[model samples]
Target: MDKKDRFTEVVKTNQGLIFKVATLYTNNLQDKEDLYQEIVFQLWKSFDSFNEQSKLSTWMYRVAMNTAIYNLKSGKKQVNTIPIDLETERFAEVLDKTEEEKIKVLYEKIQMLNLLEKGIILLYLEGKNHQEIASIIGITISNVGTKISRIKDKLKSQIKTT
Candidate 1:
């Protein structure tokens, strides 16, 4: 396939992954949609540089995370507190209602995290390994482990106190 075709295929297969990253950074539908579009634009612009050394999903995660981080830092999109009842139909299909509710609660707590911790936990939730998280976030593997442990403990404490 040509570059355009390849890009389309990659995006089609990984759209959920992109949306997950977007949702982690955004609180409302509008901002989620905007972040998704920005991520796609960045992916398309950077497609030529993707050398297949890493999985496409991994690269997409890196790009999406970076874009979201930049957007957060620039104040282009302030993170809002996501309500538990907020509809997330597009990305909620994988889970049944109960699981979805649990996820919503988890996300609510996740929103309390700092930017780096948010990225780390999101990647961990996505099942990315320590090495992959480290590479994507530009940190060492040991640091990834350390951060994930701390973040998990923090989340656990938050859940207990709530």
Candidate 2:
């Protein structure tokens, strides 16, 4: 396929990944949508330089995350509240209310994390291995392990207190 076709396919396949990263950075729907668009724009702009050494999803994650961090640091965006519990009854019906409440509380805790910790935890929750998380975040593999351990401990303590 041509470059355009390839890029289209990559974005289509990884839209969910994009949205997840966007959600991590922004709270409300409008802000998340804005961040998502910004991420997509950056991804398309950088597509030409995306070497195939990393998996496409990894590259997408890195791009989306960098965009998010940059946006957060720029002071141009406001902190907004996440509305994960605003979904309709279908989700509520599928998940036990207790499970849903736990997830909501987990996300609330996640919102309290610093930017780097948030990225690390999101990658971990997505099932990325340590090496992959290290590669994506430009840290050593050992640092990824250390950071994950600390973040998990912090989350556990915070969750317990809440």
Candidate 3:
């Protein structure tokens, strides 16, 4: 198949992954759509560079997470992350009420965190190990562990107070 076909297939298959990243990084529908488009653009831009050194999902996560982080840091592109209308929020696919509730709470808390922290926690919740998290974030394994602990502590405090 041609590059376009391959890229299209990959994007279609991984649309959920992109949507989740976009949702986690944006405040509202407009912002989510914007980020989602930008991430797709980025993935297309970088598609040729995927060296097969890691899993396709891992590469997608790295790219999508980096795009989200960049969007967060860019002053003109910055958008508020406060959860609004979370009852109306969608988690990409249908989930049980209890599972959805837990995810919603976790998302609310993650939205409160900085972009970098959100990336780490998102990866963690997605079942990425410390090494994978560190690699994606361009940090040390030890640093990932430290940050995970710190993030856990912060989440605990936030959970208790909320």
Q: What does candidate 2's lDDT look like per residue over 1-162, in tens digits?
A: 999999999998888798778877887766666677778889999999998986887889989999988876653555553433323355468898799898788788889999889988999999999988998888999999999889989988986887
Better of 2 and 3 by TM-score: 2
- Order the candidates by TM-score, highest first — what do you get? 1, 2, 3
Per-residue lDDT for 6 in model 1?
91
Better of 2 and 3 by lDDT: 3
Predicted model with the maximum TM-score: 1
Better of 1 and 2 by TM-score: 1
Give the runs in model 1 whose Cα sits over 4 Å from its true position.
73-87, 90-95
lDDT (C-alpha, whole model) for all candidates: 0.83, 0.83, 0.83
